[model samples]
Target: MIAEPHLPAELATLLPPSLHALCVTRRHDQGDRLFATGARPAHMFFISEGEVVLERASPHGAATVLQRARRGFVGEASLQAARYHCDARVLAASRITRVPVIAMRTALASDAAFAMRWVAMLNAEVRRLRLQCERLTLHRVQDRVLHLLDTEGERGRYPVPAGLKSLAGELGVTHEALYRALAALEKTGRLERQEGALLRVAL
Candidate 1:
């Protein structure tokens, strides 16, 4: 069995006491398989650090990533499903909290306040996924980058949460294409990178 790891204490703030008490932290190396498609959904993983991608097979037999998470709950929808429809793969060395699905359901059933918070979190996750889907549909790399700034940023600026290569992947473009897009944007004064990985966009 893979060994569990210690999670950061700050995560306690996001979860209710009932749910937090039931979470067990675990460590996963890069490329670890956290769960497989059609597996019984016995647990929900909350990512504390690093990254994980949730993917499913497309009709063309290629893997299509449905979600990418660096922090927050990775499988919030698993609570409503008996089995997972997508595979969860760790993209970087990670610390994740595993919460027993049964216990989580019981908490939702027993605690009205916690249930509302859980529903709110799920709604926010859906909003984020919708934005990601829209970003992936744009054909141009610069359009994707600009859309990210508009949707994910404030005041025409967005912080780079991960490496540029990873961001390119999330934007559904090759790293080289994304690099060219960034360069073009910089040259056109449409975007600029500041010292702290902060990207400024001219809307």
Candidate 2:
């Protein structure tokens, strides 16, 4: 059996001793296998390191990445419903802390702080999804790219971390189309190409 890793001091305090000692494994997954799939309320995860890509599959077997979870982000919906509504896959080598569904519910029922924190986390997820929907519905490709840079860029200067191909995939368009859109943005003063990352709309 694996020894449980230390949780953030704040989080650890909220959990009962029964849960604090629970083991969390580090894993790397390729392609699509169910780490958590559909609305099943059985488990919850706290990502300690690396990234997890959350996506929903279409009826035709197409998967669209909804968001990428970095370190410290918690993936909890899995343990709430009957099944997971989306799929979670490790984008790189990842360290994750797992908590059994029953433990989570018991904590929520007993610890006010834990319940509040969980509710806050859920609210944030909802807001993020709403923003994504707004971007997909109202923003043009150029606007989306600009917005992404504005939101993700560090300081006023940062290289475009993701390539046009990846950007296109996220935006649900062809790479050529994204390139054309980027070109248009480049022609204007909205975007500037640096050595690697493209600087956008100065911080």
Candidate 3:
């Protein structure tokens, strides 16, 4: 028999051990729709590998990516929601662990330490959202790009193992626009595109 995939250590440590036994892990292909807007929340999904995105479409048909989760929970707000407010789709081939909503709720209600850890996790997500909001408010695409590197990237370098185009959706810009901005930055010697990453060049 094949062994079940376990939760990522960062998340596994936060959830109660009892909940770990209830997790169901599976592999998903890119473009798989995990859940749709208006669907009743059945489970909380944790991305163990690859990317999953939460998105919502406007009346004009433009989709806004609310979250691009590579190694963390997706749509965590759905735990208390009656229905999903946005669609959850796999942005890249992924391994995911699903915890039944009811089981998760019960664990939180019964496990104070686990609940506190969960709250702290959510707070960190909130800060990321705030940073994203700030990035979106910047008028220049290059400014947004630099802001992402400065904040989300490690040591001023952002991994682009999937290439920079993969970031267009999260950055709320067309791939063409992002490419142009990156090229302009490269011309000015402010950015360096290396294999699998973009580095900020110090003046």
Give per-residue lDDT, candidate 2, residue 54: 80
Arrange candidates by lDDT, highest first: which order? 3, 1, 2
Answer with 2 or 3, whichever has the higher lDDT.
3
- Residue-level lDDT of model 3, residues 131-152, one tens digit each, is 9999999989999999998988
* Tens-place lDDT digits, model 1, residues 1-203: 25554446655655667676667887788888888999999898888777888999999999998778876888777888988999999877787888889888898899888778777877887798899898888888899998888887668766544468777778888899988999999998888887424365554
Top of the candidates by lDDT = 3
Best-fitting candidate, scored by TM-score: 3
Assess each prediction's global lDDT (C-alpha) against the native.
0.80, 0.64, 0.84
Candidate 1 residue spans exceeding 4 A from truth: 1-11, 58-61, 137-139, 153-165, 188-198, 201-203
Pairs that collide, model 1 = none
Off by over 4 Å in 3: 1-4, 57-64, 160-163, 194-196, 201-203
Preferred candidate (lDDT higher): 1 or 2: 1
Measured against the true structure, the TM-scores of the candidates, in listed sequence, are: 0.77, 0.65, 0.83
Task: Please identify model 2 stretches exceeding 4 Å from their true place.
Answer: 1-19, 23-41, 55-75, 152-166, 180-203
Cα error of candidate 3 at position 11, Å:
1.0
